[model samples]
Target chain A: MDLAVEVENLTKRFGDFVAVNEVSFSVAEGEVFGFLGPNGSGKSTTIRILCGLLSPSSGHARVAGLDVWRDAERIRQRIGYMPQFFSLYDDLTVAENIEFYAGLYQVPPALALARQSELAEVLELGPVLDRLARTLSTGWRQRLALATSILHRPPLLFLDEPTSGVDPLTRRLFWEVIGDLAHEGITVFVTTHVMDEAEHCTRLAMMHYGRLIAEGTPEEMRTEHVQTMVEVQAHPIWPVLQALEKAPEVVEVALFGDAVHAELRCDLNDAEARVERKLQTAGVAYERVVAVTPSMEDVFVSLARRWERPTAAGADR
Target chain B: MGEPAVSAQGLTKCFGAVCACQGIDLTVAPGEIVGLVGPDGAGKTTAFRMLCGILPPDHGTARVAGYDVVTQSEAVKARIGYLPQRFSLHRDLTIDENIQYVAELYTVPRDEWQSRREELLEMTYLAPFRRRLAGRLSGGMRQKLALVCALVHRPEVLFLDEPTTGVDPVSRRDFWKLLHDLPRQGVTMVISTPYMDEAARCNRLAFMYAGQVLATDTPDNLRRQLPGELMQVRCRPQREAREALKRCSAVRSVEVFGDRLHVLFHGTADPMLCERLLADAGVECLEQQPVEPSLEDVFMSLVSEHGLTATATGNGL
Candidate 1:
């Protein structure tokens, strides 16, 4: 596979804290690769290091065929980055912000204007082009930020939680634009806390406590880590979960909405048999029962819990 | 429980000539969780502000626990706990200090303050981190602390504006679990969220867009009302399948979802059209089946029905 980004035991230290501890990964060209983790899990640190905005204390990273540290300028030219925090000039008009970034990237004045128009159409910013960036809605600001980042037509993109504060509809829109860019052979790397957003990625890496704990497609991660995932919607889920806790096969039980999802270490057939029998004996009104496949959330939680075991230390941290 | 804890009739607000809220009519019954769903700038925050008595509406009326929001603002404020999008906790204050401050602000008796603070700290898992500065905590921890602060006064009604926008998945789960428990203690909550999955947890939800309620019901009910049927089609070379579906006359919307494509078609569309189209396109590994629409699907359908394209529309958080 053609490589878009390559990292070798990347490490970053800030005083006593090792922000990113010896992580390694490579993305195939045009792939949407995700860095998944909770807040303060070192995802931002890794992305910053890869973007050449921060120097890694050890190891190396290459972006778009340029060394991240040694050829920072060349890497910057080939990559577009949107940091976690909103980075646009709040005081500038939407059009003015795009033009400022275009000028900074040295896009030709005439070409920049054309690109701006195209981006406005794609992001629905045409009507708000004259409005101050601060006056625009949060979703509009996000789109404008994304439009400015891609104005230079960089071959690689780095977005750190770009959809953080946007509504689901706008977040979906933003992902579509990102997918369009990836379809054009531009490699995309993003970090997010939203699990469903990660489902759209081609490949993903789950990180925790400054280490990469799991990496694969969502399907692969789910199958490998979760044995039996079941969702049961019933009245008084707490009592059901409490009884299930005493069962031998049950490993994890959590409340999801009005439903209680229970994880077991055995296959679905056996787990279902036990659950059905128990609930029937208790005369419960079971709305539904199924041996459901694990959602990205279930997999993430399993991975995090697995990593807490001392015996699994080598594979996790 | 039949009578609403909060009610608004044709509520409207404006900042200068721009309408922030446009005649919103809503009600939140006691012991109920009403999800105030909307894109950013859809006037959710403004409506929430008016209902909570924080901001005076330009027209119409709102009441909290039978107290007028305009004239009896003190009564409205006393009965409700409002958590704004930007939490107003002092950065320099510790978790304990913030909770204490909130209790004082609400005029809780000195005898009851300590126990309430302790219970809140324990419930939010902040007891261990009580001495930590508010600004020093991680995003999830800070959000939890904010929630704890909101609950320390034990107000009868809770209004949370985009409380979980930036929280990690695990914490988001934990937060919602806490919300589910609040009603048992005689507390009513009105929360706004951009996450569709989280919307599933609400007892009832209002789908808002451009300052109007598109749908209001349980998540399952809203999903059943989708105008078109949705199917998840998975196949190798998804591009080929997408192209085939687009060419088929039966298809209405075809959006790429990770490795698969979510194909939407009208009820009158030919059922076997996908198979015939795929066969003609020489697509392999094609798998298709009818599936229930997710909350995201319902959200998209509502937005699209309103002439908003995910590719060319803004959704504020």
Candidate 2:
């Protein structure tokens, strides 16, 4: 199998602080790989290192079959990158921005014009092609940025929270382009805090602080990290959660909207009985209690909670 | 649930030729959390700004905490805490100093400063980081500091605009937990967010699109408006299966959820029809089962019903 990205113990440090600590992962050619983490979790740092904008403090990574450090220049030419912030010239018109980027990447002028039209159609930027970048809305600007980034038709792309503050409609539209790119064999390595977007990737690596806590297909991660969840629909969910916190059969309890999802240590039937008895004893009225599949958010919260508890305990020791 | 903490009728705002918000009507009962949810450019911010008295509406009237937003703008401002989309605090100041500064701005009594400061810090788990410069705090900690500053005056109503957009999942969860605590203290919250999952946490939600309110209901009730049964299908060569399923008359839509496709069909449609379609397309079916609709599903259905295609336009792959 061909690999688009290969990393081994990739680490980055800023003086005494470790931004990314010995992380390892790989992305196959044509795969949509998602790197998910909260802000300041070293996700950006990792992406920077891979994009050849920042060198790793230690370890190695190969992007598009070229070493990120040793062959940094070559790798840069082989990959497209869209940063978290708008990096294009705001003073330029949409067409001018696309042309400028195409020239910078050394696309022949004739081919550049053709590519420009192609991208405008694909990104639905035809109506705004002559609009000043500064005057465009966030959605249109993002589409323009994406079009410019891929103007050279690189084999891999790095989208750093491309939809962070974008409207849902625009986000879906952007993902449509991303999906199309992946179909045409362009590897996509995207980072986002939005769990739903992660569901679009072929596989995911979840980062917290500077460490990777989980990595797998969403289903695998759900099964491995969050084995079972019992959803309890009850009014005053906070109090019910408080009561369940001390229950021996409950592993963890979290607020799921108006309901509570409790991870149970016992079998489903026994756990249901235990929960019923406990809630009854506390006089906490519940509308329903049933076992349910864990959502991606549930898995994330459970893993984060579990991860934090051990670290806190170790700190105490 | 006495009088509404906030009520707005026909609230409208226009920027040049673009209508940012149009005839929006909203009400929030005292002590309730109401989420204004929509895609970007959906007028969530415009409506929020109007109700918060930051921007005067182009037409209509609004009252926040029994104070007319237009005629009694000062009173409305005095009774509410507003956190904008961006972090808007003095980054050079320490967390404690920022809180102190906001307290001073709100004219918080000198006698109440120390205890209120300590209480907010403790509640947000930022007590230990009080002396840390806001600039140096993590994204999560900075948000917590921002929240503390917003709550410094103990306002009756709170307006948070996309407060968790870029924060990590752990911090986002932590922030929601803090917001969940406010209603019990009689502080009503009007939060605008682009995230559907966060919308689920609100006591009520208003789904907005193209500067108009599409639907307003509890998350559960909105989900029930899907008008069909959702079938989750796990199949190989998913792109092909999805395309094939879309051609079936029984299927209303097919949404990609991670590696699977969620096919929404009329309740009277036969599930076996989907299997036959996939088989004809030579896609191997791994698992198929009925599943409940999530808030996202509801949002997608509503948006599609309003004329936007529910699925993003792309080559099936």
Best by TM-score: 1
lDDT, residue B133, candidate 2: 82
Output the TM-score of candidate 2: 0.92
- Once fitted onto the true fold, the runs of candidate 1 whose alpha carbons sit more than 4 angstroms away are A236-249, A276-285, A308-317, B236-249, B279-285, B309-317
Tens-place lDDT per residue, model 2, A274-296, is 78888999888888888888877
Error of 2 at A310 (Å): 7.4
| Cα lDDT, model 2, residue B228 | 85
Q: What TM-score results for chain B in every one of the models?
A: 0.91, 0.95
Give one digit per residue, the lDDT tens place, for model 1 in B206-232: 887776677789877988887778887
TM-score of chain B, candidate 1? Answer: 0.91
What's each prediction's clash count?
3, 2
Instruction: List the RMSD of every prediction in angstroms.
Output: 3.2, 3.8
- Candidate 2, residues B165-270, lDDT tens digits: the string is 8776667777887888899887999998877778888989999887789999888789888888999999988778989999988888888766678899967546
TM-score of 1: 0.93
Task: Give model 2's docking category.
Answer: acceptable
